[model samples]
Target chain A: MNRYLRQLKEGILDQNPTLVQLLGMCPTLATTTSLENAFGMGMAATAVLICSNVFISLLRKFIPRQVRIAAYIVIVSGFVTAVELLMRAYLYPLYQALGLFIPLIVVNCIILARAEAFASKNKVLPSAMDGLSMGLGFTFALCILGTVRELLGSGSLLGYRVLPESYPDMVVFLLPPGAFLTLGFVIAAVQKLRGMSEERRRRRSAAPADTAAGATAPVAADGAHSAGEADGAGRKED
Target chain B: MNPNQPQPASMPELLTVSPSPHARRGVTTSRLMIDVLIALAPAAVWGVAAFGPRAALVLLLSVASALLAEFLAEKLLRRPVTLRDGSAAVTGLLLGMNLSADVPLYIPVVGAVFAIAVVKQLFGGIGRNVMNPALAARVFLMLAWTGGMTRFSAPFAYLSSGVDAVASATPLASLKGGMLPDASLADLFLGRCAGCIGEVSVLLLLAGGVYLLVRRVISWQIPVSFLGTVALLTFVFPQGGADRLSFMAASLCSGGLVLGAVFMATDYVTSPVTGAGRLIYGCGCGLLVVFIRYFGGYPEGVSFAILIMNALVWYLDMLTRPRVYGKTRGRRGDRKGGGQA
Candidate 1:
């Protein structure tokens, strides 16, 4: 259970496939024009990622090392075709909206990366968990990007108007350049938050040493050490 | 950074101690900004007078929002406040000039903020921005609000009639359709046409360009090459069987060609550093302007053209790099083999 939770944390926040690892950029940038499309793309990609991961893990021993990549592509495409047909049959609107990107998911880097990196090496259950966690991470990033793009680009979210009628829609947010701009900013903010958390973690770890030194050592020495650490933090940012 | 260094005394004599040959020109970022502002003053005043009080309001809002954005961004980023340098003011004014005067007041404010905070500061502040801020903001605004950006009111329509004067098609729109605009060549040249606030007045813009040229604030290579290429292309292949001279004149005077050539393309931070590179960059801008004007969806291509060229400035500089003092023209490998041979 603890290992599963750690995997969840790593996928969602620490090593987000889209925002952190920067995988599957094509779908992230192209389908994120609206929350509906983004959610659809994310879910579809997630479905493919899980199915491929499990199947690849099952067939890991049979697949030769030289033909592993070719076999992985075949497996990923099978799952992608299944997801595409499923969406087409049930979620026709989303199927039409995502268009070419749904089929392109067969080539999404995250799925292939996980299939080769985790699924081929791990057992079926663990491989499935890895896929679920990574899929959730991709979904999280796409949803955030989609929410921002939709709210600004169309003045709505998930097919509902969120802003006032008079609000001017920034049409650029619906365009390709807007996608790149929003992604760049989202990544920057993620990095900033990660840095802040790391800094806090460092300070927290250093606090016990400071208290311990204060009890026996001189106050000036502790102050100097902290000051030096603060300077180092500032330099790290630069 | 050196916290242990001894603090310097407050005495003026000690502060003045420095390297010899201490004489310095009064030039600074602020000084150059002021020069640009002064050169731009004539066209800005003309725009206001021609477009009326609403034009003044747009310009005022743009300038104010730019300054506010700059101050707020600097404070938020915890950088030293350098508002006194006036670069923000110049960016604001130029952005205002690029906009149609009748746009909703919020348009200029949004443009100014985006110009300063996003395009300029977020990219690492003055002298570090990749593209011209005002132009980028103008493009952003245009893309965001195509209807508002495209709507142009006739010159002095507000002064003679109500503020709700009907919008007119710009000359570039007519030119795009291969028909001469309603305004004559003289009217187009003298700023009597319906267009963006600062771009309509070719005569005044040229005067300002001349002023900058004389002040040595800008070199002539860019504006000359840019305008020259446009004139040559339009003259050689006059659109719609129009007279060569007339078409060339109209192309040179219409839309933002003069304004962008004189000011935006010549932006120091984005343009090439060397003369030859500037010429290539200028020609590239002109060629793109004509290309887009002729073939693109948008009738006016000044903003897009200059921006496309701005991205190529580094390559242009590299391509036109001055030769090393003693090096041969060919590659080092070829040179070594040739010397041995």
Candidate 2:
């Protein structure tokens, strides 16, 4: 249970598939042109990821080391095929909306990377948790980007009117050039925020060392009585 | 002291030195661009005379708006003001020439803003843009304001003279819509038509083209290959033999082809620098123009064709790289050397 919890936490935050790992970019950019399409594609990809991860973990021992990559691909393609059929049958509209992208998920680096890096070595429960968490993380990131693009491009959110009628939509935001510019800026912003937090941590660690040195220097320069008094207060605080 | 001798009492002097080609040709960017502008004058004058003073007004508005947009974008982006590069002015003039005389004033302004700010400077300015800035902006504006762009009527006075000047579509538009009346080759050559400014008069536009060619400001290959390819394709697969001459004339004379072949398609940034690459690029553009005009929804394909070809220039250049001196054409298993096997 503890191992599964650790695995889930690592996948969700520490090594997010979309943000940190930077995998599965084609679908991320294409499906993200509309909010509805983004949500549909994200859920579809997540379903494939979880199923493939669990199956790969359970069958890890039987797969030979030399042809492990090919074996993993076959398993992934099986799950993806199932997902594709289900979507076509039950969710035909979304299936059409996603178009050629559902088949492309079979090649998404995230699923293969997880199978090789984690699931093949880990037990089934932990592997399933890893898959679920990472899939959710990817879905979350895609939603954020989609919301921004759809809102700015068409002045709507999830097909809902968010901005007033007076606001002019920049039609370029929906074009190919806009996709590149938006993705580049969003990645840069995330990197900048990470850098800022790291700086904050360094400053917090250095502040107490300076204060402690100042207290020690004055105590040492004074007589034994002052030194004893300073030591006593410091020990009490500690 | 001998007059021929140098002054001996002077301390060692610092002399500024420059690289060996110190013999300089007196050509500034401003002056070169100004000369190109002068070269473009005959076409502009012909357009105005044929279309009237409204063409002149569009030219003025487009030039001013392009310069102003360049100035404002530079200020906003904190880049050094480069309005003096003469590139912006050229862009303005070409854009003006492409537009009909009576297009709404705001349309040119919007087109100019897109040209200078988005297409030019955003891609790193002057020589760095991937597509011709003027054409890119024009296409963007055309897509955005399709009603204004395609609603080109003849000059008001030309219409008022009982000249049977209906809201006639351009020859390309007529050809695409399958409504071409029996237009004559002679009429097409003479500038008695309704079309974009600077595009109605093939002879006058050719005069400007000849001047540019004589000046060696642009090479002959791109223009020749581009126009030649279109001519060949039209002759080979024309719609009808009865109107063959008119079809050929219309193909050359209609919207933005002369302007694009002579100027816009030859843009320094978007066009390939090597000779062979440029020829290939031109031919590709010509083929696309014909393909789109014949089958696609758009009436004019010059802007889109040029833009698409611009995207392929890098690949074309790679494929047509100049062979290095002393390199063998083909040698097997020469992996140790720089040559490919």
Best by lDDT: 1
- Highest DockQ against the true fold, candidate: 1
lDDT of candidate 2 over B1-341, digit per residue (tens): 23433568987779867789877888677776886788778888877886777788888889999999889877865578988878899999989888987677777888888898777776656776777888988887676556677666664445367553346666776667654533455566666667778777777777777887787778898999999998888767776453665576668766678888988888778899899998999999999999998888888899999999999999998778776566644343234346552
What residue runs in model 1 are displaced by over 4 Å at the alpha carbon?
A210-238, B2-24, B329-341
Candidate 1 lDDT over A60-170, as tens digits, reads 999999999999999999888989999999999899999999999988999999998999999998899999999999999999999999999999999899999999999
The recovered share of true contacts, given per candidate in order, is: 0.41, 0.00
The candidate that achieves the highest TM-score relative to the unseen native structure? 1
**DockQ, every prediction:** 0.37, 0.04
DockQ of 1: 0.37
* Candidate 2 displacement at residue A76 in angstroms: 3.4
Colliding pairs, model 1: none
Model 1 chain A: weakest 10-residue lDDT segment is A229-238
Q: Write the per-residue lDDT of candidate 1 for residues B279-300, one digit (tens) a residue.
A: 9999999999999999999999
C-alpha root-mean-square deviation, each candidate: 4.9, 12.2
